[model samples]
Target: MSNITVCSHPIIQQKISSLRSTSNTARDVRELVDSITRLMLHTVTADLELTPTAQEQTSPVAAYTGLEISTKLALIPILRSGLAMLNAASDLLHTAEIRHLGLFREETTLQPVEYYNKLPRTCSVDQCLVLDPMIATGGTAEAAIQILQHWGVKRIKFVAICVSRRGIDVLAAKYPDVEFFVGVIDEVLDRRGFVSPGIGDCGDRLNNTA
Candidate 1:
């Protein structure tokens, strides 16, 4: 029962709409993605735990206590395209531990292969955010979630720019507790395993390969 959330924010809608057209250059795509990622993260991080602490001496007007996030956050951005979302996610959670996981799909089988992993030494956290721009086949997201589950993360959230019905089905069946937030559900997948009406291959667009 993966908790799925589709962003209805107008700002997100407008930003991502610019991404649908392939005419945009790599820099344009990256900017649009960063803006959309920040918008999506607002919803994903809403439930983060907080703790209040007393301040000894702070404001010039008066002294007061303040509340700060209590949860330890980890940002696991699947390699290549996920890297595009890192800057936005970092701005949202400045204190979070960032890890890089490199996974590429086997072109013939549509399976994910882990080529690199650099998780934090502790390998544990109160919350984890998995970032990937496209959710076409869902193999990569599932693999990353499994890794976080084994590391003892109590809460996990998956964020993407846009989703497909097929992709949502894969996670909803297996991850009832994980939260899924995407800018939109495109409702189709191409034969080559790409989300239809998507931003195209985000990695290729950002890295200028395509």
Candidate 2:
């Protein structure tokens, strides 16, 4: 599980607790999700490569070397629910290309069904970050990762608010080279495949669809 990073920041924990409440309005849920994603961005991007550039500039009093991220990046947010986390990621990686991958879980099968994909014919980014609010059964996540890999993304990472133990295990076993950054991991999935004690139906909560 070395590739998995579970954030334990108190503020993130507090926000996750609030987000799980049934009492929050759609507005409240959206705000909490945004805040949590923003807080987690630092840890997710901590290892990005930086390179010195000749574009150095002088500050008010002193000259300083300019450094910039060298890796070409892309943000692939699974549609609908994943859109909730897009803003925070885009704010941090302002130049990253944005792509949408739409997938939904089949109620009876608990399997992922892909409905939309916006990737180009050939991969152009060095690293890709998959943004989704929850990893429930791992089916959807697995499908998403496979699509990205098929598209030729070499370095991939998944960022989410919550994940299930089962989901993490499934992904780790299949994609050992991939990385996961999540706020918390619940112990199990409910009978219907939702994460136990997880942020309930994130898309519904974010959009008041439920």
Candidate 3:
């Protein structure tokens, strides 16, 4: 079964609420997204394995044992909305590689169209975290995941600010082995394939184009 973690952190909830408001400026949206991504990542990476250092580390005044992340990680942010969360994810996972996957939804079909890919020919990381602000119809997310899977990624976790029920259901059913960490799940998707009460074209909002 797919593991879905809906963030319940008070700060995350408040930020999501702020994001949903129509009055927020593009700056407000970007700041809020940065904050939310940092907070949510704490929960998303909590279970990552750690390994003790080969030798004790010396502090300013004393020596102490230290541990480091044992698993290698890669951040795959689906552009251009996914780029909004990239800095926050990078700040948290300082050593992780950053890759970009560009996908867009066709207006008529609501299917994903890929125009850019930066993944290596062979997988180099132990786990991959896909970043996208919203998952409405799930087409884009599914397409991004397919690319990663095809590149030989064995573990993938999707991180999103919000998701629609239809989106999550589609992804969960199709990629049961993958995990999801999202701020909230809205129950509706309008006929136009937009999540009801969602942040509304996060790419446009982030770029102040909407």
Which lDDT values do the candidates have, in the order given? 0.87, 0.93, 0.93
Off by over 4 Å in 3: none
* Residue 204 error, candidate 2, Å: 0.7
Q: How many pairs in model 3 have backbone atoms within 3 A of each other, for residues 3 or more apart or on separate chains, i.e. clashes?
A: 0
State the local distance difference test value for candidate 1.
0.87
Best by TM-score: 2
User: Taking the tens digit of each residue's C-alpha lDDT, what string does model 3 give over 71-121?
Assistant: 899999998999999999999899899999999999999999999997889
- lDDT digits (tens) for residues 38-60 of candidate 2: 99999999989999987887899
> What is candidate 1's lDDT per residue for 1-210, written digit by digit as tens?
348888889999998888888789999999998999988888888888888775665788987778788889889899999999999999879999898889988889999998998775565578888999988899988888888887778888889988888988788778989989889998889899988887788889988899
RMSD of each: 1.5, 0.9, 1.1
List ranges where model 2 is wrong by over 4 Å: none
Order the numbered candidates by TM-score, best leading. Answer: 2, 3, 1
Per-residue lDDT for 205 in model 3? 92
Each prediction's TM-score versus the true structure: 0.94, 0.97, 0.97
